[model samples]
Target chain A: MSGGLTLVVALPLLAALILILLSRLERRKGAIAGPGFFQRNGVAVGLYLAVAVGFWAFFIIVLPQLAMVDLSFRPKLPPSQMGGPKDIFTLENYRYFLFGSTTSTANWNWLHIKAFFLSIGVSILITLLNLAICYPLAFHMAQSAPVARLRVLLLLLIIPYWVNEILRAFAFRVLLSSGGVVNKLLMGGGLLDAPIDFLGNDVGLYMGLSYAYLLMMIFPLYNAIESLDRNQIEAARDLGAPWWHIHAFVVMPHAKPGIASGCTLVFMLSAGALAAPLVLGGPRTLWFTPIVYDRFYQAFNWPQGAAYALILLFACIVFVLAVLRMFRLSLGEIAR
Target chain B: MAAAVELEGVNVTFGDFVAVRDANLTIEPGEFFSFLGPSGCGKTTLLRTISAFIEPTRGTVRIGGRDMKGIGPNKRPTALIFQNLALFPMMTVAENIGYGLRVRGVPRHERDEKVKNLLIQIALPEHGHKLVSELSGGQRQRVAIARALAVEPSVLLLDEPLSALDLKLRQHMRAELRAIQKRVGITFIYITHDQGEALTMSDRIAVMNAGVIEQVGNGRSVYAEPRTPFVASFVGENNAIRGRITQAANGTATLDTPIGPLTGRNPVGLPAGDEALIFVRPEALKLGGDPPSGFEGEALDVTYEGSITHVTMRVRTGQKITLSLGGGAAGILPQPGDMLKVGFEPQDGLLLARPERS
Candidate 1:
């Protein structure tokens, strides 16, 4: 309902409309080699653009987003009590998220804010951890291994990812539990006097999330690193560069787009993940998705849930944009 | 400060496959040495062993009289310009050239100064700020060479670095590379499958085949007096005549071939009744010759190639022999299907024992 939000949604639509009008005008003016896919493939590209804009944009993205925005700006009411004169569109849900509920009497609620920041911070940490864990493995799989061994390694990496994420997280849950294998092994080795509380805190959740998206982080890196000419590395070595320098100056810069892509994907997914947190996190661990879950299911507050979900989506978008900027890459480059 | 390279009985094998077998070579300092062969001839493998990229399976490699048994490529007094050039596309031309200096902890000011001087050396002085991807293929090649030379290695190993360039640029670079090597006065070991490049650029050429070095000599010697059948067949085009030695006398063999009796210098000196092959350059055979011996055949085809006319003839026994005559020999030009007499001086023909069929 705000002018800013309206403009944010309308800017892309306006650009698309301008492009379509210009293309039509150019078509009427006569055939010319202008910069448009429509000019190249003729009516087929126009038909493709029409289908994409008409069906996918409307049904998948724009319509659902509009519905969410509408829901977020409305009053929450039961079905029997809905559509009454008293039930009016309001900013109560957004206000309730920013401040506290009416009974709290606080100027601004810190719990939701703290939870959002904590989730974002930890998601970033998990993304970084995944990058560290997957980079060397990806490099080894892509370059160091023989072709036959590389196939076996790729199969091992891919096969684990084929298991559902939730099941994988539960498996982590079992391993990270107090009486789990990790703790037993540690205790048996006399490294610890007592069982560590991995799941009781968010440690288990972080590990589970990083492990759950390990393949997503590895594949993009593998594809990028694989394209690097092995001769470059050997040339660097022959030029008297140490191994670390070779990676720092040659390999890492080459894999930047993949790193950005993997980080963005892992950050977005982990930030919005619900199951890992629910399964592996303790009651005190207040991840933002659990709050959204609480609002929609437990408190039966659809508007508040929509508000939280939209805010999380916006945060993820900002993160992706920031990462793209930091890596000096476009979405197109990352997609490659 | 150039260094000589010595490979003493070096053998490199990977699993069950022998890449280089019993190689012994000594490359004098400041000499342009080239390994000439077809692909999979182990020329590149031999070069890598000298550069210490791969350790020899059996013997030792020495550079400037220092044993190179345990030295890696980084510590060796040599740098390799890869076959692909391998210019770091992410770096600017100056950065790519300065990388060797930078890694050695050289100060930025010194590195930049050296890089600027190297840009001039490669004749791309204005393109230092440009990325490697922006340069033409030949320019990238120069940058790669300059980058390797920046480290001041006493020996430079080049692995077919000119293979990617177009023909004209490749020929042009052959002169430029030789000039640079001479200016630097470093031992240059070049690898290439193209014999033209090897012959034109190298001070000495080692002809290799099937993991074995068949012969090592100057370009003229290798071409004029090849010791092995493979070298004679590989180094240049030759007209091969198979025969059995009927008489051996004073380093000359008289062979009874399908084309008729022929006498030539016999290096292998197979005894009487032994199978042999005599090879003669196309230019050595001439039309309407009558001394020692000659072959009478029907002229099958005549191809005029600028300064010379190549004539293909089939003798009565049904073997093809090709001869090149001077283009100005218009009066002597034989038309196709006409009977022609072609003969060569006994000294121009080289006779060797027949190579066993694989």
Candidate 2:
């Protein structure tokens, strides 16, 4: 029965992937048909590449996700009684996410639902914050900065990313703690009478998540803005547009695709983030992923965890679609 | 709102490299002026200084008799059309044309009306609804011009705006741009490396070399009476004879050359024994003339260009001299290796001190 269900879900996904590939190939048919991949790189080498990509896509990505989807719809039965009379397909796991189990006293799982929504809301805030920080920096690097200054700025931005993500998160924790260097400086400088509760209010988490994915936002914005003609900005200025007006009317409109791609990347990554939340989240902060994490490992509720994971994945897909619609951008444009 | 532009000892330098130096000129109100030079000759820099994009390193830029030292480009009453047109690709043609008004907080209906009128003026009435990318090259050029003119600036600065078009379209735009300038009656400061573009469109042309404005005069005067050797060679095609001045009297000088002593008008009053170059246009040199200033050479190449035939000949001293024959005058064309006599009247040639560097 699970095998049948897997096939039903997998076939459409396979068809969609094939259609995308075919359309892309058809668009480049003239160039491809002239020399062709197999002809240019020997047939043996082409086959090897094809087989390797097929193996990675099916086994590493598609099969694992399919297995999780299949698991989410089934009951969590004992190993000895697996696939037996009591082990059947059900929605109890997903229902437990919205309303507590029948035995629970509460009518709804308000804590978990609140956490889920809060996680999404906070991720959005982080994405906006990243955009605000990256846009000007990217614009400066791409348009106004000298080549030497741009090189130095690029090196500074990239060097910090060489550290492991978890280590970076931990470093943020150290910096944001009550007795951290930040608080010490604030106190010594007479800017604060006491250390601010950066970690207790989730400020550290937001800062950590924003810093973690900054490069994701900057590079795309820089790439898009760099392709814009410098004369467009000059023309605007020559036409009596002030600096901010020029950016609002000309530069921002041109960077829409970059903004869309950057927002999607930062939002998706911030929503699914584990290391940053685990290290920098305050005791009061309850993120959705931690709940999903507890179900999978601590509580050993694999079915419920898979169901929650799928729900989060669905929400992310909806967010991506909403962003695309809002920006009036196609996936192909963002891909560029 | 036409205004006179005065640049007094304007100098612009980037660190040690001087882009434009000691430029002093007055552009009369509503005059169509042009800065003509080859690439890297500081014409664009001078235009930028006048437009307030670059502040002159040491001078006063007075627009309408007001000192415009620290004003930004937006604050200045000048509009610039970039070389590439620089139309906003994301905006419709109407929006691109009306962007200046929009920036100034003009009402929507009024801005739309103005944009519509501009579109009609540029002969792009139907293209207002289309994106900039959807228009053809010539349409985009017109849209850029309309965008600049929409601001109704006192001065319009153009930086080789027609360079991207083909020959046919460039010629057409030249007339269209000149008509627009005349109709508006504003100070038009045009910058171009194409001598034809400058000569055909501008009321007066300032020829620049390196960082110096060598000569400023009307097209006829600049071409017929160039004050410097750079202007003489740069303004038109000329056969340059390098020699030493042997005699300087009155307004003419005799140059002792490899072939013979050639005499021409000395506008610069070069003294005897000074190195000099005499330039004579190809059309000035006639065929089979028994003039005192004449040379006999073997024809090396003959190119028939419909209305005119150019005969390239090598003199005995191995110097090449080109003489052009009018369409009907060259009934019997000279072939390769045929001996030809090329001559030009003394008054038709110009002699000036040789430039420090070629």
Candidate 3:
């Protein structure tokens, strides 16, 4: 079945490649047979590059995604009963997502649904918060800071990210614990009356997620803002614009592509995050990915897990499209 | 309305490098003044000091008789046109022009009206709705000017704003800029390395070099009567001869050189036996005329540039001197390796003290 599915997808891609090559050859009709064709090695190199990339993309990315989507529609059954009538295609797995069970309960899976929405909402809040913290920092690094200092600043930002993500999340868990250094410092400084329940209230998760995705937000913003001519800011100020107006009218508008790319990346990563939630989530902080994890590993139900994963993927796609539309940016622009 | 700008004892330093040192100048209201110098000559630093972008390490800037000690660029009554123009690419031409008004909380309609007037004033009425990136180079230049003009600044500062354009457009923009400055009746402080721009458009030009103001005067006087050796060499193409003063009296001195003793106007009146340099402009050298000082050289190259011709020669002292001949002058153009005689009148040559080694 997997072999047949691979053929079904591969045939169309092969045909398209042949058609493109044929058209290219047609444009250079006599040149292909001429001595000049052999001298110009770029065409041959490009063809080989394209074939290599296409092969890797099809096998590595497209095939696994197609398998998961196909698996989402199949019934979960024992291997001995795989070809039996009970092993037929069904919407039972998807229905389990909407309702609580395969048998009609007439009841919604409010817990999972609520977790899904909460994950999305929190991810968005984290995205905005990251943007707010990173914008001024990126601007300073790109424009105002001296070159030597900027190098030091970039090193400081990058050195922390060298540690593994899960390890960093675990480190945050320790830091935000009741008897952690942060609480001790606050109490010692007389800024707080007592230790705050950072872990119990999900503040640790928020901090962990924000810290994990900060570099992703800052680099793009820095790249975009650095390309801006310093003269434009001076011109705005010379025209009597205050600092805020200069940013709103000149800097921010120029940085829309970077902002869009950064926000989308941060949001998607935050939503699909498993390590941060597992490490830092409090007792009351229920997340959707863990439920999907349970359906696959704990319950041994691949179909239901696939269905839930697809729903999350669909939601992420919708989000990316909405962000692209809101920012008036093309996919190509953000790719840069 | 226009306001006078005064920079008194201004100095700017970046670490140990002095960018501008003790710059003192008073720019009259409604006057078109220019800071003319080569690259890294502290002209831009002086201009920024006046515009309040950079505060002088020591000294004061006064605008319209008010001390601008702690004033920021946004609060200053001056606008700067950057070298690259720096038009906002995301904003339409009209929006870019009216940005200052919008920041001041002018109503939308009022801002649009003012933008429309500025567009017409800049001769870009139809381009108001176009993005700055969509306009041609000259149009963007006009938009930058209009954006600066929208706030009705008492002083407009330009930093080599024409250096990016092609020759024809730069020449056209120079006339256009002069006309706009005159029509608006505001002080225009223009900075450029191009002496021609300063000579043609400015009411007065300040020649600067090595963190010092060398000379400041009307263009003709600055050109004909430079006060320093640096000013003489920077302002125009000149044949410089190194010598020691043999005789000095009555604003005239004789310099003893490798070829012969040459006499010229000694504006600084260096005494006898002092080392001096004499500068004679290319145009001032006559090809074959009886003059006070003369040299015979072999012609190396001759270039004819429409209205004028330049004849380059290597004199007996192994120094190259250029002579400019008017297009109307009927003479045989000399080819390479041909012997020729060149001379300049004493009054046409300028004698000044030799610059000390840095």
Candidate 4:
């Protein structure tokens, strides 16, 4: 890969090594009371570090990312001149996507950048909509419902997802089709003069993406709100706080970690989503993932597709950081 | 600004179970009243009824002579300190204390000023900026109390607010709570299963048992003249002897007992031949003393606690009686199997008709 990719992969591993060494030193010096983590777990810290480093940090994450970074930095070569100068390492693909290449008359296309931003925006919008829809539903499920009822509701919510995601997207396409039940009902109710083209617009894709990941948002919120002490709400009420104030001041603050995590999951998943957009989107929709797919499969440009995927990955990380910062939550809290 | 809280025939039922039944009591204005009972005895339910958290199934709850029916907890003129204190962990001490003011739309400057004064009142002025989690158990207890008081409610309700503290801190906070109540001069209705706490802090106490208020009186009255056998047994350690009332007169009844006839003052005045039980406090019973009447027993155990020596003895009737004697009894410590003579004045023992056990 490139030097930047190498550094990115090495940095976290180095930090983990430093932590392990420091903790080991502290144990030998008896500076801390308890046994070191590895000793307490009855295994050497190195073994645990090996499992984390070999299985997770390297093989699962860094290796695949490094391969992609390598592919992204290379230039596209034709089949006839497979090992030609065009195959050399270059930033041409990234440059093309970010600033658009000079044509016969060097004009800014702005298509790729606009698509990138639009997808990010739609992802954020979906995240927010899911939050607004799920918070109350989750709170009711976790706090008010009896155990058996909660289980039944959770089962009902999850049973739909047992079907494949692609199949689910196709189901949405059928449901939102011009001659489908939704349009038929609207027309039957005299709410529409003509059947609207749902799949030909942004609305169908956004709705499908949100529905695909709705459980990802609800479970975290349910787990967090469930753990909150009900007495806090009662105490707030006893202190003269109204319903809105109680939720604003007490409930939301206590659920920050869950909110952060749920938003992160939904944002990341929706931003990188391909199946829903593929099934439900029309010419009007220009999702970033479709562009990446066109580059790799249709146009036969692996380097450019890799670059696009890398950019989307980095954007997802930035979004997660922004969410954590906005909520004043730490990674440790989200990890819980 | 204190208000009298009166519950007239208040009853709380959850589905098929009755939590608080026919609770009738009047808490005088500015009075430090307590509901003392074991777990699930409806003390907390009664407190919640007054706080408007739980509406009574029957009758009316009146605060300051105004009916509080249909009033939500927030709209009611009462604040409750939960058992866990329930201080907002996310908020600073000042913010927790001032939450009520903020909810009432008080200006920031006014809220800050009131929060500052409450911090001093709670003796945590420097810790106002610290989160509730940062405070010690006693500090959290004080903060919860200050938070409840900040709203300037006519009634302050506390539900075992000191139960989480250690023994020393719980004892200390008892005096602190009573002092704060005096300073605020608001009707403080505290709930606790700890009888010692109720006896130490309350102006009057209502001892509840099985969804019923067995007795309501001041600490001294409840301890010295319990009207019911439940009150006499639950309030403190009491030695009881089952007997039949052979002779009933004026206010005293002579009970025919297993260990011979015993005479004591009877407030219930059960007729002759009615089943009765006589109760005597450990402190009221004396050992190694000449008295009007005495019993012979063998000392089974002797425990020395700081200021008192507790002697557990087995009487001729196989009844276990405990005697709490002053430190002076240290010199005359009764060993196991030692012959012991213990007796009490007739007025010290109370005779009550035992209600048939369900």
In terms of DockQ, the best-performing candidate is 2
lDDT of each residue in A208-261, candidate 1, tens digit only: 888888888999999999999999999999999999999999999999888999
The reply for model 1, stretches above 4 Å from the true place, is: A1-49, A77-91, A102-105, A188-191, B1-3
TM-score of each: 0.92, 0.94, 0.93, 0.94
- CAPRI-wise, candidate 4 is high
lDDT of 3 by residue, A155-186 (tens): 99999989999899989988889899899999
- In terms of DockQ, which candidate is stronger, 1 or 2? 2
lDDT of 2 by residue, A84-180 (tens): 9988889999999999777989989988899999999999999999999999999999999999999999999999999999999999989989999
Q: Report the C-alpha displacement of residue B252, candidate 1, in angstroms.
A: 2.0
Instruction: Report, in order, each candidate's fnat.
Output: 0.83, 0.87, 0.93, 0.87
- Residue runs of model 3 more than 4 Å from their true location after superposition: A1-44, A102-106, A184-195, B1-3, B305-307, B332-336
For this target, which candidate reaches the highest TM-score against the unseen true structure? 2
Docking band of candidate 2: high
Q: Which sections of candidate 4 miss by over 4 Å?
A: A1-33, A43-49, A79-86, A99-101, A104-106, B1-3, B288-292, B305-307, B327-332
Colliding residue pairs in candidate 2: none
Pairs of residues clashing in candidate 4: none
- Give lDDT per model, in order: 0.89, 0.90, 0.89, 0.88
